[model samples]
Target: MRKSFFLVFLFMTLFVRTEAIRIVGSAPDYAGQRLEFFTVADPVSKTPVPFFEVTIDGRGNFTIEKQITQNTYCFADVGVYRGRMVLVPGKDVRITLPPLREKSFEESKNPYFNPVDIWLKVNEGNKKELTNLIARYDARFYQLTDTYFNQLYYRQMKNYLDTVRIRLEREFEKEEEPGYQTHRHLRMKSLEADLLRTGREKVAGSLQQLTPQEWTQPAFSDFLNRLFVNTLSTESKSAAGTRMKMWVARENLAELSKWTQDFTATEGSLSDLILLKMLHDAFYSGEFSSSAILRMVQSPWFSQNKEPRIREMAASVQKKLAFLQTGTPAPEICLPSSTGTIWCSGRNTKPFLYLLFADLEIPVCREQVRYLKTMAEKTGSKVEFLIVLSPSQKVNNTEFMSSNQIPGIMVTDTPNRKTGKEYKVRSYPSAFLLDGQHRVVLAPARTPLDGFEFQYTDLKK
Candidate 1:
């Protein structure tokens, strides 16, 4: 009996924890606080969705263990103090967050006051160098875009872009680390995306010839966005005006597929990118009916392409479409109010669901929240006017609400906010609108104080 028990215990010990990721960290100043880790599911959305969370002990040490199978880009976020990290499968990663000024959080005036200093030591790994390399590449991309996008040397732009690409290649070859080849590709794509986002007409000619492997990169999506938008700018919608619709609206996927087939015949396998691009444009444009788009994405036309990556892109697109679609059920959003009580906003019987994820440290959040208050007053009590305030020492919810004389439901998130992750809020003061069934009508609802006031009016029409 003793021998059998010993053998069973040894077997259990050997097999039980082989696939889990162990994270250990110390943030002395943040004792008794929570630390949340998140990963990006889709680079297009680039919203950090929560994986798991841990609470710091009285001694300022914290440990977290999560069974994560996928290798992904992840970050540790504590409201104003956020630190980025890359999480790989079955790795034990130790992160040490150094102390910050206790009063830094209270300085509401310095909108750019960031206090977190991240020091990561991944056991038996080289993630630090890899992450730093990615950051450097991003910096180079932003620098090159800002430098070349508006220059008189547009004729020599191709040469400048080539030089940047070559530099990136040389840097990648130097480290040439395994498990990080995808990061390099992602960086290259970012550079390309930013170049296209610059919208210089000449950039279309200068973009490096794309490979099938790169079709899934964020840069590819950006380039596709530009291409799709450029094509839509060609035709006028009415007889009286020369202005064309901002997006090329079609009745169904058949029309979009026809265009894709033509573009592919000329550009070869770029049809795959074109298809993904169209899907992106549809979602980002918010011009099309969700049901129509969902039906098209679910159609076999996306799979008939024969390229596995394109098929995978179609699948990914479908997941997001389902999540943000008109009839799909919304996720639970239970967060704490100023009274330290959790406000489960979507649980109640409100006719409409409105969520405003705000960060008062940023000026835009403040502006939007004030504007939201004005709009919410007009919306009446039937609509759940829930303000999901992300914690900031600079902007205390109780003080701000009282000082501004703002009323209604206010839900404050803990330092490690699950609400932000739940909603996938990337932009400051993001707005979401849901139907009576708590289905997302507008994943990101329009703001009253738009920079281009007439833009929303035009879109609504």
Candidate 2:
């Protein structure tokens, strides 16, 4: 009986260790605020997938737990700053946030604004842990780089770089954790790349030699992304680039992959990844046919790739490019009005659906909505005007619409901001026009203040 009890205890301990990563933290200055933790789902896009949110209590204490199988990078938006940390499976982390510094109105409204990234204070962590090791190594690396920037860059001091590299290697030599090993190796390589002034082709050659799979590591992906930034623009001008464009034009995945391998001197899965990067980057560049690239992503070559990561990433790419473009089907929006009636885009009665996402708190959005009333009055039955509101905006919608004579259906998105995210609505007054079949006609269909009346008149012709 005693032996069985001990075995049971050990098993339970192991199960707990392998199952969850718990974070216990405090932000005394931000009491009652909710902090959402995010992890990268698709490394190439670096899209932040929200894992969980914890609300700080009156005392500014919060605890959250998430299931994970490996060391995962996690971050939380604390006011205008993003606090980041590496979470190890089975280990509990205790941290303290810095003082709250909220975002200004303009910053909050800016869609392209990024939060300042800062390392959270790990109040409870062993020095041998990957998080601690990485933090220490980065600090030293930054110090060394700062101390010898000019000497390394213009002076071409190989001896100085060697000294820095040796110091970093010696200090971190004992870290056997696979994640730490990859991070250290990539950081050292990046340092070498900088000091040696390695050209893009040489970096590409070095990337080809790297162990083919390190997609999960932030360091590896960072290096990969930096090396391939704007590759489409640069490569398309090359002699090989013309053939690559032809392959993409034909929606030929096989030839595309081959082109990538030939151009970069990389083989197999690495070349496939590089090609995906190129396709993803070029999607918004207007350098290639977006529709053709979208078809290639949805092709069987990617969907049935032998590598699971490639399949997953390709699916991610497809989802991102699927909507919001001209001729693509608009994302369905079915929301409830204050009067309890459900309004859906599919049930539109007009030949065209004019969808408007507006926040009343924003002056510009309010101005546009007023302009919309005039436009709606003139359109007659040819167009259906729909307005989406944020959940936080609490007003007598019926009174406001009636007062403004805004002839439109008003609906508020749920607290999750689902509609806004689906429409990729970042600013206060984003608008889209959909056709009779709910296909996107004008991606950002011009706002009423921006001569959308003339644009719509022309479209009606």
C-alpha TM-scores of all predictions: 0.57, 0.86
| Candidate 2 backbone collisions, by pair | none
> Where does model 2 exceed 4 Å of error?
1-18, 123-125, 154-157, 195-199, 202-213, 334-347, 391-402, 414-418
Query: Candidate 1 residues 40-71, lDDT tens each?
Result: 54434343466788889998888978785444
Global lDDT of model 2: 0.78
Candidate RMSDs in Å, in order, are 8.8, 5.2
lDDT of 2 by residue, 75-112 (tens): 88777888888877777888878788988867876789
Tell me the spans in candidate 1 whose CA falls farther than 4 Å from its real position.
Answer: 1-21, 25-33, 54-70, 78-82, 88-92, 96-129, 132-174, 178-255, 261-270, 286-291, 303-461
- Give each model's clash number: 0, 0
- Taken over the whole model, the C-alpha lDDT of each candidate is 0.59, 0.78
Lowest-sum lDDT 10-residue window in model 2 = 196-205
